[model samples]
Target chain A: MSTSTTLEAPKSGTWDGGNEPMKASYGKLMMWFFLLSDAFTFGAFLIVYGLTRHAHTPYTGEAEAFTFSTEWWPIPEKVFNAFPGFHGVDLPLAFVALMTMILIFSSVTMVLAVEAGHRMDKKDVEKWLLWTILFGATFLACQAWEWTHFIVGTDEGMLLPDGTTYHGASMAFNQYGPPLFANLFFFITGFHGFHVFIGWTLLIVAFISTVNGVYHKRGHYEMVEKIGLYWHFVDLVWVFVFTFFYLI
Target chain B: MAHHIENDFQQTAEIPKPQTKAIWRTFFILVGLTALEFLFAFTMDAGTARNAIFIILTIFKAFYIVAEFMHLKHEAKSLIWSIIIPLALVVWLMVALLAEGSYYYESITNYFK
Candidate 1:
């Protein structure tokens, strides 16, 4: 019923800095607490988006008028293209879907690495951590490609009847949907892509540390556990993004 | 003392026994579930039905991820509830906002016409 009840402190434990009253280690517990607050922040953004979508006035001009149809979020398929080689091909956010899978699969590898660390298998930890890093990097690379595709118009710019060139990432919407949708799309997903970049950097650091015998010397791989928390958090955020932005 | 230290090092060097087949079985089940999600996404049209299915499948995926991968299922009941209850708040907030927003939107559209 109360916030305190929801956030009830973990059990008291010997490692919990005597008098701290929490059973979990300071670092691990802090990660959970941080994720909890971050979750609320994202929740607010999504709720506002829902509110805005409800307020949107359907564009009901001529068939050629700039607007969205009920079919899909107006021309999401037209706006998002894969790369240079695929000119005029309608892939419809295929690249973003791939990026989502990469992140989710990396989360799998991260958990495996954490499990290895728990069992004190340094070599297994290193292997899986490396795999996690590779997946993260792949995700980052795909995002970069997506960004470039967004900024650059397809082979020839999409020409409207009025002859105004419609860049894929334009501030104007075509028959597909609202212009604000594109603006919000770039802003929100770009911000998330930045987080993915940071996550990749952190995983690289953990990977290097494992290779250099840092955790082996420390007698425990709590560092790996901490990074695993971060990696999984990124994946969790993507779950929301995939649902709200793409599927919903 | 030196002999005892050597014995401890030897024990540490020995690899721990692998987990039973149950772990791999669970992992394969997760893979199958993921494949199912993909199949639904590709085959289904975007509508209320597709959205409902996506939501259900995503929740299932998340449950497995949290329970098995994150080890929450094995944790204390209190700990598990601590994570679940807050997340439930988030989902509730999303649903409420969407419903209210859609209602207001409909009212405004009707007023303009």
Candidate 2:
């Protein structure tokens, strides 16, 4: 049996790019287009990040001369090591791991929601959508806490040779290493957080429509499926961000 | 509750609850990958090898997300290539930019000395 019912040609008709290209609706194709371009933007951001890291080492000049290294990039392990409510304990990546898990779980919830859509189960779709929204919101709350900790800074600031002190991440002063690290962190994570907020809002819209019987009347849940695509794309982006910024 | 109990052929065919075994399997795989990633962060020191391992795992997770969760794997071959083909350029962009950036860095360090 063929994988797609729609893609199977009529008994013997000439093939043409019909209303649905390769069995995908216009909206689905458009969403894929938007996601593809968005991926390019993220690629550019990460490439720039790698570029900066290549240019700037921990020390300024050669080791023999030493000569006051201007580019003092901090090791990521040092800056992002604390867990919420566990003061004085260094949990390097536990919080981020939790956040990653939460987001991955949300993606799973979204897949279940889409699967429910395929079965035309409005109630189950709504239930799973709500769960996804809850997971997404939890991830956002964790990010807010991480940002707050970074700003308020439990760790003491580092001292430069000139008697100046570098405090926790601001655009100007970076306690971690160079100010650039802080700037990238703010830009990358802040940008990603904004996407999460938008995704949550979209989930609410989908949930409302599901509750209102919009899809039930239409006898299909393609809208839920479309939103699922967007939601999963967000999780995919976070996977890359987590690998590059946090791990490496 | 109105149309739910009807014995209409189409309605009966569209079961209200589909088996979710695949979904549960997917969840476990993704979570397991993440658990392994977390373990790596703790056990392994940062370096090229560690970074390579992270990237490989990330690619695995990405494949699972796109193929399984997004259901693109179920779609037609043409549609899959339409998206993947353009993304290959992003890889070229990274290599080009980073190589030039590193070259400039080598010059800058030499000049500073």
Candidate 3:
């Protein structure tokens, strides 16, 4: 009957602001702090990426004479040139664009769901929450398609005239871009995608709980607010990804 | 159990209301900037100009996301500064390391030549 059960006292009692708990709800507040720390970790990754990119030889001039070929680190456009059903059409960076839109739209739906929860509009909450889940699923589907497009070349997975497949990573080079670019791309986005998967699972659980009248019985929707924070955090990280990885 | 409607109602009253139209306006601005980034990437010859355009647009989008979606603009000045200052530091560190690394790379390549 009460949501108070979800709150617990910290061992140190440091969070005890007099009678109030040091934090808010145990689960929700902890998620916020966790996201803040996670933000720092991603910051470190981006900083390292910038450093490595700076160290790489630029794609021009006398430097080309010293290397095996003047091709330089494959430009991001040259590397990620994939789209559905346009064989060799050179639709550079199309897939990443779609991924970006998917992430941003999902963030929109998440905020809407959170808004509905605040209004205590149960039907709106259910609808918007379902929409949020659908958007998340769509984003994941797009990511999978992007990976497939990356791995198997544009059509029938044919090799280029250079005798290498259209998509594959090598120590010397990558089909989509420089080897480091592809490597970091997979690592960073893959980790973020994993977080989305986790967020989706939490959202689904919350949706089911709402259907079962859990929040109705408890008289509050703080759980939805907490999950919304996590969802928004994911969108926030993608903003940086779009900037540093895609744009720059 | 006593029903503390007074406190509960007061808390509810203090919860800031969503400015729907303002949020929509900010969202459109973000989408517009993203379009500009894509256009620059596609149209411009790859060079310093393209890179500058991308970085500028990215900063614009970041500003909107933080100010609008995260509601940092509505928060206390201390809270705003707390988040912004650290973010600025991170960006500075990234740029500094990148510039220094580039210089070192140029020197090493020239020596080898």
How far is A144's C-alpha from truth in model 1 (Å)? 1.0
Native-referenced Cα lDDT, model 1: 0.69
- DockQ by candidate, in order: 0.41, 0.63, 0.30
Tens digit of lDDT per residue, candidate 2, span A1-248? Answer: 87766666545432554445478888888888888998998888888888888877654343233222235655666678889899979677788888998999899889999888888877789999999999999999999999998987655566678987655667887667777888899988888898889989999999999898777777788888888888899899999999889888
What are the fnat scores of the candidates, in the order listed?
Answer: 0.38, 0.79, 0.38
Docking model 1 quality class: acceptable
Q: How close is every model to the real structure, measured as TM-score?
A: 0.79, 0.88, 0.78
Score candidate 3 by TM-score against the native: 0.78
Interface RMSD of each: 3.1, 2.1, 4.5
Candidate 1: lDDT of B17? 60
What part of the reference interface contacts, as a 0 to 1 fraction, does candidate 2 reproduce? 0.79
TM-score of chain B of 1: 0.76
Clash count for candidate 3 is 2
lDDT comparison, 1 vs 2, better candidate: 2
